[model samples]
Target: MLKHEKKQYKKVVLAYSGGLDTSTIVPWLKENYGCEVVCFVADVGQEREDLDGIEDKAKASGATKCIVKDLREEFVRDYVYETFKTGAIYEGDYMLGTAIARPVIAKAMVACALEEGADAIAHGATGKGNDQVRFESAVAALAPQLDVIAPWRIWDMQSREELLAYLNERNIPCKTTLKKIYSRDANVLHISTEGGELENTWNPASENVWVWTTDPLKAPDTPETVEITVEKGVVTKINGKDMTPFESISFLNEIGARHGVGRVDITENRLVGMKSRGCYETPGGTIIYKALRAIEQLVLDKNTRLYREHLAIDFAQLVYDGRWFTRLREIMMAAADEIAKDVNGKVVVRLYKGNIDVIQKDSPNSLFNFDFVTFGADQVYDQKDAEGFIRLYSLPSRIRALNEQQRKQ
Candidate 1:
């Protein structure tokens, strides 16, 4: 009788970033799976130096082909703007830097795999972090038939030490060293840092944790007020200059970073039911978020704003947990779009020493009524009308107090 043969994945497309983890993964997949590995690099606005010579590095690491695509416009316009409209801020701190970028990268990887006629996809996300769930969930949703090979789960080689040694044995070169202190992920919206000194909750983040922003204490003494204009929840102009979404964010990132506009160090709850510490720099995103919120306050009515706040909390959690590809996020974002339809306005934001303050805001759709709000004798509102209104409004509270008095008696 012939022996049973286990089918092998003939080819695998890897989501490659040319980073410490991914650089090693290219070789690891080839040796372990006995498959031709194709590298797919998505440029979503990381530092240009990161992408330089990436193709050569992939080929040197044994990849059959390397594909790099720029997704900056789509990333900012579709994902970042959509999330901004929802006012989604994870745990009131993180801007969902790593979380939001994953879906775009994963979607591109799947497309590359299909184009290359590959049977499997692989990623270098560690077993401990949220990226694994994000990458696999996206692949599962987009291409269920394609096999997902999460090396961190199946591989016996654990730790940075082992990864380095594995590459050493194969004579593969990498830029990372054992002295590397932080594990970072960067893109257009923000840059995030984890591991190293951040694991200790009580210890304050040192200067080494910072990348883009100047130290708040060392920031320029002069305050720079930036004016932004929003049309339907999207920033259209910065300081009277009309720009595309990509140009707007890029410009803000430069100026905001100069003044240390966005920096947050917090212990946040991860989607996998654990607490983790991270430091993030989201200079441009902070300005954009503040400006859009100012527009919301100007244009959104009282009840609509209240409901949108509730929706935003839920949306933040959904985005943080990597549910962007789901219908729940789609419906919520659709509702957010409706809520922000009238969010057309201009805002003046004051940026100084890591602080962002909205100094002035005006909107064509503003519900603010000068006649109703004036302390002076107002023709539109009567002071006597408040007596009846307050009575009806406080009826439930009045009943509760009376009931308490009766019980005491």
Candidate 2:
């Protein structure tokens, strides 16, 4: 048996998902540790219709009470906006949807624990996953005094099969079984699916598995164009229409999902030193990245853009590796924010069958000079100026070659 430490906690708050792992945890806490478990769930825009019976489900699974809080607006404004401002994309592909949300969700759980006077807070994150690190690290940063419990790390039940048997032996009702299940996490920003048939990258994802997006083949052939405007590093409008942060993102997610805009299937390296295959849906996020990059071209200067890009890769890696609460991450985000001060502009994009096309862009800070760049007769840029500019640009290489020739002679 895993020993409960000398630190005794009476009221325990659990990060509940209404999944098999979390469902079993409520009872396990009661049985193993003999404590009152208060289930806490954060609604971060995961299709709420699917989560209809979750409150009752948590209550039935040995939880003393359940708290489901709506965090959709806060999630978008705080986490999503911060990520957008940083321009951090993990491995140059993923938008870090799941990774970014972990900190905010874990923070909210800790706040709830403190409010309820719980001595310890618990999570259903598995030992093999990145979420465990994210949850633990945030707790260590925000509420270090509180005890943390991760049942998956301590429990002897190893696999999904073992978990099912553990529940069955105790006559516990579980939605998942030994043979049929896919591990899934859904939020308003996206839906992620792993395990089951997704473990094999060679296998084709069935249409039934995709719940949020329309199939590209079935999507309308006509392309739709949208204009996104950013002010003070935040997305302020879509299609020339001003909207609240929640309204704009929700509007675009629907529009983009119809065109199959954000579907990524990859075997990414996890924080725990393992490769896990997953399919992520990030409809509006894709559009945001595309539009934001176009705006960056209009506003960000060459050196600032290049240096910020260097920081972007490392910043992305830190977030992906679950180091969001660290000092390095804070420093990088600060740099990114300063670099983003001038990244305010309008970007028009066309969506057609999984592609985001930047149509037009403009900003008050734009450096693009139409008078100098135009092919027509222009006085500002003389044709002869290119010869001297090219020679000056290549001077280092020319000197190196001349020295090498002299040495050879």
> Against the true structure, candidate 1 has what lDDT?
0.89
lDDT of 1 by residue, 1-409 (tens): 1123224679999999887778888887786778999999999999999899999999988999899999998899988988899888988888888888888888888998999999999988777778888888889889999999877777777678988998888889888888878988899899899888898988889999999999988999999999999998999999999999989999999989999989999999987788899999999999999999888987888899999888889988887777788999879988999988999989999989888989999999998889889999878899999999999999999999999999999
Report model 2's TM-score to 2 decimal places.
Answer: 0.94
After superposition, candidate 1 runs with Cα above 4 Å error: 1-7, 404-409
> lDDT by residue for model 2 over 205-273, one digit each (tens)?
877568788788888899999989988678889877888777778998999999989988888888788
Model 1: how far is 185 from its true place, Å? 0.6
Alpha-carbon deviation at 68 in model 1, angstroms: 0.6
For model 2, what is the error of residue 118's alpha carbon versus the real structure, in angstroms, after optimal superposition? 1.5
Per-candidate local distance difference test: 0.89, 0.84
